[model samples]
Target: MDEFTSEELLEQLQQLDEQPRIEAKRASEIGKSVMQTICAFANEPGLGGGYLLLGIDEPSSVHESFTVCGVTDADTLLNTLQGNCREQFESPICVKGQVELLDGKKVIRLFVPELAPSAKPCTFKGKFDSKNKRKTGIWRRGLNGDYECSQQELEPLLLAKSGTSYEQIQLADAHWDDLDLSVIALYRTLRSKVRPYAEELQASDAEMLYALNLVRKQQDEWVPNVAGLLLMGKPLALRRLLPSVRVDYVRINGTKWVEDPEHRFATTLDLREPLLRLIPKLEATITDDLPRHFRLKEGDTQRSDEPLLPHKVIREAVVNAVMHRDYQVNQPILVVRYSNRIEIRNAGYSLKPEATLGDMGSKLRNPLIASVLYDLNFAETKGSGIRTMRRLLKQSGLAAPVFVSKVIENEFVATYLLHQLLGEEQLNWLTQFSHLHLTDDEAKALLLTREIGAIDNAGLRAITGLDTLSASQVLGRLHHQYHLIEQGGASSATYYQLAPQLQNDDQLPLFSGEAEASSEPNTSDLGTDTSDLGTDTSDLGTDTSDLNPATDTDLPEKLSQKIEQLTPKARRDKLWPVIVWLCALRPYKAEELATQLSRKETHLKHSHLNVLREQEKLIDYLYPEVINHPSQAYKTTDKGTNWLKHQGIEIE
Candidate 1:
């Protein structure tokens, strides 16, 4: 682990709360929670392990700051921690511990180094659940904290231990015929254009595929692996084999998501072609739908029409989504086109940390797929895609794209606003805040939050060209001093949105009431036949009447039964799914949810509600921008619904 002093560690805890590589515990004595964190630090693949500061308490809602509650018996705590590390796991782990003085008190600083790949998956000795095959004692670090892994979540660790990737796995039912010859030929043609004498081009089909590691011999016959099927599989084969591996392009008439069944979307198209053909088709579909601007170059007689968003920027965004997406997920990539922005939501979070997204290195989840795209000049192999997009968007005078990478949710969303960062209308909006005498950068930050509904340090840095510290300070002033914005989330996941007073009437509709009052078709006109085109037209409406606190007579039977069986002593994990189900039925206030669950309101908000909404991305505030609104409540998001489906829990 990188070296750091006690002073530096304390500073991090105070400023950023908890980080991926740092944890604070008031461990007067070593316990299960501490041991789990140690295991997580050791097992996380690329974390390089983390530091645990004993005798420090995490910031709570009441505290609002980390407190240094020094250790009472440092010698005893050290002995217990060391003993547990050696004897409690499947393999012995080596750690470094030291007793240090901070604020005139004693504390223990321990660093847990990540185990080697061959010795990974450091599971507890006797914690396996026999009844459930999915339960392993393995732990991995997440954005929220350490979490136990299910069998499905353990595949990456096992693959790393065996020195292989998911792409190299040969599917049992796959055959040589699953590969498309025409796509293979297209690859050869594209490769030749890049390199006329490429050695792979000189080889036959089987030889070429073998050279690319796309095919492996299994049971005396060469068959396509996951990478091969993803790159060149026929549409029919993909539908039969990997039915969820497709792209959905949705066009909406307004600026935000619509959940009403009648007018949720304007034009919907789903494409399941192979990557080689699919990329160009997606590009064309998006480019054709974008608003155009005419430009006449010097000495040209006729004007040329170009998209408002740079074509290069759009191409890079599309290519980056497919090239870096996690194929292990059973969900489709969604490209949503709103009136003012385009959002590409993919399954995988970035392999690199969100802070260093545009840094000069590549962290590949699917190296084989990325290799092909790189060779064809479809993507940058050195992590320059984001940088390229930013540069092109700047040249076009558009607001910098905002990227939200949620690790716990296992999702990433890239939002590109279609208008200039500070256009005439935006300047007019800024006039409202001129009496406060804000700086240019501060004004830009506020305007960005108004346009996109939220802004973070990274986003502020992207638009104003400020470093991390400066951007954070600007946001700090706006949130604390001026009170123009309200902050949500913690540490690196933190974000700020317009405060309740500043969420003016000019803001666009976030739900389906006034937004759908136009001449759009009603529920009866738009039939419920969504299966024909794979379009998701289901009514995910935010109707909260059934479970209203005023009359709680109409709860779904499954939900009602689950609520009736709840106990006060139940674990938070057990309550999480139930809470999601409840919110799916209707938005619920924190106090109301607490009363239903038989927990204290303050405890529920601090322990469960805040974590679910800010950290997990499972639930979101009903009035997100106006967070302190009188009727503020929590509702389930699409990610929360997907998580429920994965857990095999169905709510009618």
Candidate 2:
């Protein structure tokens, strides 16, 4: 744990919100509860470490003020705390304690480092688990407070203790004959196609399995392993060893799960075949059921009917689910088909963070499985699968898939949107402003803003294949110049939402039909959201005619009364532009303009007839644009509609 400076420490003490990494206690003396915190800080995975403060009071609310209530006897407290850590805990925990003068009183600060993976689940001597429970000798820090680890939570730790990869672990007493020769032959055929010159294809079946580490010579016997079983085991063998291993293909009627009590799935299919055959079978079943769209490639002579999602994309998604999922969880891979979307949910979070999912190269959780798929040209171990999925979705005119990687639940979910990327309603709405000459990226950004409340750099990167720098430029251009999106946040935290006029949700079409429903929750913010691609730009249209409304204040007031007498409609005509220019320069009373033009009040109504004001535009009340105060005088709009033409700035 990094040591916190005095200022950093003081800021933490004053803050009202509780941080998972910070724990404050008024324990000036050693106590049992303090040890639990120490154990939790050390045992909890992933939050670098935690802090313990001896003399601080917890603030009740954000408005409530707090102060460091400093320890009275620092030496005695330190001695007792150190003794408790050494004697009461199952193991001697290492923590750095410092005595500081806070608010003119002594305060003890302890920084407990996260325990090494091997020595984790730090607990007190009494914290061991019962026989039926998995978590013994483990205390972990959660958001609310410290708690003991559950069985499921402790399994990952035990797997970590093996120091052997999951795929490499030998299946005890399983001999080579348990493997199917036909599966091995099929692998060789696939290897020949992808790696024509590879030497492994020529090796004997048993030798090939041994070379690939699928089968090992244990105690002079060639025994198979978990990877061997998954890739090539017969049906009966797999069922007896790993009954939970299979792909569950569930079809739902609408775009989401069948969450209602009475609602049932459209169809369900459980495939118990070996992964070698299950991969293609699952793809075929889904492709046959998905709606097809006719598309043409660039410079192509003919159009072909393609599924809303590409064939390769579905293959990659399923392959990844099988290749990267945590097989230890004893859960089947769930391939859910909704009316308009398909969701692939499997046990285990992604091998890498959500931010890096699109980047090449990933840490493989099941390299043995990955290697087989990679060798067969069925999947990639280098992380190109996500990039392919994104590109294909965009090419198909479908919204990009959303990948929600939940580390706490150890789950990875891929939501493949089946509906059009830009709905016909949304496109029709944008087509109204062809004059805006918006680029594709800008249009997509607007479309996103129209659906979701806002968009950010991360969102832009997922939708478009833009790098961080490129994404920022697109957002900045639309915000600073085009006036399409309003900017929010500061620096890296900056986000872009549609301008107020563009946020017309009541008109956009709702995303409906067989689109895959997102199994993951929509709880991410701009700072943490990853590839949501779920915004339904249902009702979006901007009144282009009303954009850039202008009311020039300083029109030429010296024009003749006849010129002033021009009707508000006639004032916008080319001939009356001189008077329009004069009125734009300065506000003039209808009577004054009538007198100047040598015309009656009735004539003045025609020439200086407050046309914009009558339309509730150029106002008769306040001169500062109608939305603000408009004066009773016949002033033109300040929003700059025809001000440019009057100044000879506009050619037409």
Clashes of each: 0, 60
User: How high is the lDDT of residue 231 in model 2?
Assistant: 94
Cα error, candidate 2, residue 267 (Å): 1.8
Candidate 2 positional error at 581, Å: 84
* Residue 393, candidate 1: alpha-carbon lDDT: 84
RMSD of each: 5.8, 24.9
Clashes in candidate 2: how many?
60
Best by lDDT: 1
Report residue 152 deviation for candidate 1 (angstroms): 1.1
lDDT of each: 0.78, 0.64
- Residue 192: error of model 1 in Å? 3.7
lDDT of 2 at 596: 47
- lDDT tens digits, residue span 1-652, model 2: 4578544665754431224667778786677678888988887655567788888775556535456778888988988888887887777887888888877888888888887778765667876657757356677764336656666666566666655676777766577777788888888888888888888877888788888878888778788898999999887788777767877666665543423325444555667777899899778777777766555789999977666678988898888888888887655787777655677878787657576888988788888888888888888657788888888878766788866555434567676766665788779878866888988988887776565445666556666766555666777778877788786543223456677777543545545433332222111221222121122100111112212223322223333343546554553443345444434544455555556445576555543353333322332322211111112244444433355455554312
Off by over 4 Å in 2: 1-30, 45-112, 121-135, 141-145, 150-155, 171-177, 218-221, 419-652
Provide the TM-score for each candidate, comma-separated: 0.82, 0.59
Per-residue lDDT of candidate 1, residues 362-443 (tens digit): 8988888888888899887688888888888888777778776655457778888878767767777788778999999999
